[model samples]
Target: MTEQKRPPRAIGASGLSCFPIGLGCASLSGSYGPSDDDNALRVLHEARARGVTMFDTSDKYGNGHNEELLARAFGNARNSVLIASKFGNMAGKDGKVADNNPETIKAFCEASLERLKSDCIDLYYIHRIDPAVAIEDTIGAMSRLVEQGKVRALGICEVNPTTLRRAHKVHPIAAIQSEYSILYRAEAEDVLQTTRELGVAFVAYAPLGRGLLTGAVQPGSLGDKDERLRHPRFSAENLPKNLELAQAVQQVATERGCTAGQVSLAWLLAQGEDIIPIPGTKTLSRLVENIEAASIILSDAEIGFIASSIPPDAAAGLRYRAEHMKNMYL
Candidate 1:
């Protein structure tokens, strides 16, 4: 079979560039559920075959298993694709702690490179901010990676506008990865403005709302082992309320003759050229569904409806539990 061609697009604030839509590999290694190596590799290969040239993964995901899976899947294509990996969330001395110390940052980058089987990472992100360490100190360490040719660019995940600016002051932040979807418009309305003002690209993770907006996840649809089951938005008490919000999205999507997922992603793409959504899935059908969203455009009226339909805090429950929520927006 002939290989599928990748789409031409720029990535990062520097326009140091890559594919517009990246494949978020978190699911391949089973953050959501169990996945075999063979199945995971097939998904990666299929994504590449479909022209996905940007792959995003993190060390904490599957406890480094995800990176190893990517290395094995993209052995030869490793250089062809822009590999974006993250660090700073690995277990620390306390066993289940997060650390972003300069020493830890450097060590983590080295380990990620070894696992990815690459000489240099296309884009490296700090998975989560460690409150104990100053943002500048963390970013300063990351900047050194760029100078050492270990990382091509630097990014941060789940950071606030102030943190973004602080990090940018230390080094040019190429991108910011955060939870953004039709159901989660709080960031788009405000955080997006900050990223735009600073010329930093926003990488939207969970752009499908952990399958909520995709019309695939109904209350009790997720397996008990799934981590999302514990998420406030997906908990038993909030699931019905959240589903109601998704149903409203479905109505709008029906009017537009597109899947709810497509409407959600298209709305994000329309938010800004600097915005990129990395919605992950293990199934080929779902992967294709997500990629098509890039082409789904919304008229001004349609965009307004979507925006108003799901207000920033429209969904029931907090995005994450209190413990995890404490780690975000830092």
Candidate 2:
């Protein structure tokens, strides 16, 4: 695949710009399967060479191994890249899934900075909203990071419009990360509306539906140890029906003269400039394919057809398991 020549996309009003497509570094730390350190470094370097400035990871990913990996890849040329890492998802002393205590936020930032080996994080996000904590208190603490120059911008993941509005008032949230794809559009479209109203950018994670829209991962094809196996979207009853939705993408790809993954990404790029998709990959070829997707502009008619092919709720299963659903989109 060839490199794209598009201009950088801005992250809200934070004065930060990056390639339209960023690299989500979760898989590098074994989110899906085992990974090699040297091979992961090659992929990161190749992404940088292809103009992907934004590298997204989380402290909970591989227990901070992901951040340390980025530190090794871009420690010498930090200015050339945008490091977007998250906190609040890792379990704290109480054994909870989220930890958004104001006092802990600063300590989390310190630990992430140490792992990343960087002076300041380009974009710091609350990986998950803690229902027990007020959004204002969380954002208020994050704002102080901006004041102290420890973080350049703030973001939140799996946020709803009301929580997003409340958080924005406490501190300007530059972005919101969430699972957004053609198969799952209900919440993300609602989010786009609020983000447009507030000037907050949408960082789309799992833009490919965790590979359902990629056309490569078929029903029952995932390895036993793959984390995606735990997601309800890939369940025994759901995978077949979901793959059927992906077939729609394959049809569009055929008409567009590109791969299914490229067509899926191109349709997303056509949504709006404020939406940025971070599709993670462990392969060099896929990194190039995703970067090239930024340049494939679909006609309005094609975009509409793709959207209609897979309706908002066409997805077969929940975004996550029943036990974990309560914590998402809070």
Candidate 3:
């Protein structure tokens, strides 16, 4: 097992501590493109060897393939890594996200535990808000899982202040997972103030802007199967403009002698200690690059410079399509 070289950062008041940077694991399930199972397992083991102690997954990722992948990769090493999985968003046969109901929350939690081959989940997140069900009802059922010892900590993803306040009243929220990157910031930055006030750790998913900030993906270069192709920022018209923002990140990376992805991750790290970034990769080299980003120190001026280069709302497209965006930040 890889030993932790630095002190762990705590998440909210749940007493859960992990390396500030984590492996998001979405790519392992082929969210980006096709993935080889053996190679994905190798990447997971390599992440452990390199001190990435937190692994984030969701039931909706490849319809539980990602969770099962985590189970197979970790094996006996499960205890050494923090397993964070989510529920609430169900994918239908039509490939559309269904409503989040209490029944689904309980049933999904049970199914997730079975797939993970673990008795308890370290961190369980409600992947997205279900407008059909009250936040209180959903969180109330989640609190029961905590009481039953099935889940150690509770978290909610992509929720606004009102929902956070309501959910916290039912159970202490350990963290808030959202698409927070320098590339997409308005809503998440506003949510950060509330999470910080409530002492909830902000888990920044896609902290690398779904690979655009890494200066790797270019307009018209993504594979057809790549999920990013469905995102607005990656659209043909917006992609050219988004690449300009990526160029700004790349320029800084060149000046600092680091990868553009590292510069983006470093910028997120500089936001606050309470913020933790989970940048995903299906390869070991990119995993190590993301893990090493924690050491890239940025001064206040550099942070401001990067911000100016890619101002808030500068990215031309929405983070998700209209149908998908409706479920986020509720």
The C-alpha TM-scores of every prediction are: 0.95, 0.98, 0.96
lDDT of 3: 0.88
lDDT (Cα, tens digit) per residue for candidate 1, span 6-33: 3455565566766567789898888888
Model 2: number of backbone collisions: 0
> In angstroms, how far off is 4's CA in candidate 3?
14
C-alpha RMSD values across all candidates: 3.1, 1.6, 2.8
Look at candidate 2 and tell me the lDDT of residue 104: 93
Worst 10 residues of 2 by lDDT: 1-10
Clash tally, candidates in order: 0, 0, 0
Give the runs in model 1 whose Cα sits over 4 Å from its true position: 1-9
lDDT agreement of model 1 with the native:
0.83
lDDT comparison, 1 vs 3, better candidate = 3
The 0-to-1 C-alpha lDDT of every candidate, in the order given, reads: 0.83, 0.91, 0.88
By summed lDDT, which 10 consecutive residues of candidate 1 come out lowest?
A: 1-10
Better of 2 and 3 by lDDT: 2
Clash-forming residue pairs, model 3: none
| Candidate No. with top lDDT | 2
Pairs that clash in candidate 1: none
Better of 2 and 3 by TM-score: 2
Q: What tens digits encode model 2's per-residue C-alpha lDDT throughout 144-205?
A: 99999999999999999999999999888999999898998899998889999999999989
